[model samples]
Target: MATIKDVARAAGVSTATVSRVLNDHPSVTAESRERVLAAVERLAYHPNAAARTLRSADVTTLGLVIGDVLNPFFTELARAVEDEARAHGYYVITGNADEDPRRQDEYLDILLEQRVAGLLLCPTDRVSPLVEEVVRRGRPIVLIDRSIDGLDLPVVRSDNATATRELVDHLVALGHRRIAIISGPTSLVTGRERLAAFRAALAAHGLEVADRDVRIGDFQTASGVAAMGELMERPDPPTAVFAADNLMALGALRWVRDRGLRPGSDIGLASFDDLPWFEFVDPPITAVRQQTEEMGRAAVRELIALLNGRPARSRTLPCQLVIRGSCGERQGAQ
Candidate 1:
């Protein structure tokens, strides 16, 4: 059977545009409407009856999809999003993507099927075709934490480049010439930005980033453990190592402890994410602190603006570099 998607493709317009033309929405341009009608007639396209019925139902909810629920950063951000949503007279339904693109797509599908008003997504490394369709449909979607290339969606995230440079400078200032980094997939914006910044920072100090100094991680504890193991076993290992996130930092810490290596004296350690537990460890971890609450609130506000037919702008909040004992210093010395 001819479907709405087919009509949209044939007309060279978004499915949302086709819907607007069919429903006589005043915002649609006459040229778009004419094209859509011509394509519909040629294709004999019919919108799904069930989907139309579902979309007609009143929607007072928003969908929030996070990268991973186990990550404390995401857990805190979700709470802040929910709080802000309630204040705006809207309820939020959250889905944990668990760092999987397929799971993220499934959540997005379920949310759209339920006719949620809008979505806040912490995107995976790659964008899905369904997400492209959603964008073309003119649905309100605010990206939180991560972004995909070629998408003009509003985004709320940290200033990763500046924060990473600061972290690297600290490591260099501590007389650590040979430094290494455990980073997430380069396909992610955060991963790419941090890795680039690390290289730039090293270059600024008249140092080169050797290929062996960079280890690809999955932003998970297991990857961190493996990367740390590999780094420590090298013929000439790095004197300092930076993990891109808290979970990975924890993994690195575990590996260091299991091998009877002290963090500050034996080798330095740092992380991109700051957690409450960092302070309680034997040697506290130095980290970059992203404003998760502010990010969440900003994402909700931007999404709400879109819902109200107002223009929404992307925002990058500043990050704080918290120096602690793990990075070759006493907790309060720096």
Candidate 2:
């Protein structure tokens, strides 16, 4: 088998240059990198990743633990992280927390056991002992999409409070005062901030939220469906309903259909996270479109910065309000 030295000789470059090319060092010239790659291919030179990692005592992999892989938002986030990490010559190991704190802890332990160079997590809980331990050990960590308070770590997420305000403002502009909401779990920052923003927006409009008009969901479809059912069954149902997440919005839609109520006519509907399918639905959903891919990319960048002994900062990106017929802003059929 050809060694790094053989590849270096074939490419007419120093062994260090060949090594730099293999590791995707940014300083290497494009021509040099191409020549090294061609020589590697010709010589069939394959570096032993395990031996290299062991010899260097450094991990070239990043662990990304998402809140829920089943959620398309998280899935897309993972894809973006993987794409960015690969571009930087790093690999990603992803785990799904399934929105369970215990499961999230388990995944954290598993990732740590693998000795990843860094961690990216959409935390299920605001505080975790395992995460604390990891931080105490001086491991690089960057929170994505969700965060825990009291933990000094870099984070990448959307500005939920602002987005919620925008959604509520849109509903109020459409003359909706008695609006109901399906909120996510209070334990999660995303859920709590959104619910608080909704209330604040209503207060700004001189409207108060009634207890009967609010239902706390688990950021899941079933919870949304159940919450919608409870709201619509009330003696005085709300004219507009907002779901904190996309899955819950879909669930609310199911409840509306089951009750023979047409969205955008009988009742206005809005959601937090927008998806491609939202546009193709019967009544296109008005939603808060977060920069999910950018969130992922930012998380990886921050983590890389931390790993490189640089200052990593927390960032919150703005979300766009996508107007559609579901919010009763436009007249439409079905």
Q: Each candidate: how many clashes? A: 0, 0
- Residue 81 local lDDT, model 2: 99
User: Which candidate wins on lDDT?
Assistant: 1
Q: Which 10-residue window of candidate 2 scores lowest in summed lDDT?
A: 325-334
- How accurate locally is residue 223 in candidate 2, as Cα lDDT from 0 to 100? 93
**Taking the tens digit of each residue's C-alpha lDDT, what string does model 1 give over 164-254?**
9999999998899999999988988998899999999999999999999999998889999999999999789999999999999999999
Query: lDDT of model 2 at residue 229?
Result: 92
Q: Residue 164 error for model 1, in Å?
A: 0.5
**Candidate 2, residues 222-300: lDDT per residue as tens digits?**
9989999999987899999999999999899999998888899889999999999988877788899999999999999
Error of 1 at 177 (Å): 0.7
Q: What shift in Å separates residue 122 of candidate 1 from its native position after superposition?
A: 0.1
Name the best candidate (by TM-score): 2
How far in Å is the alpha carbon of 272 misplaced in model 1? 0.2
RMSD of 1: 11.8
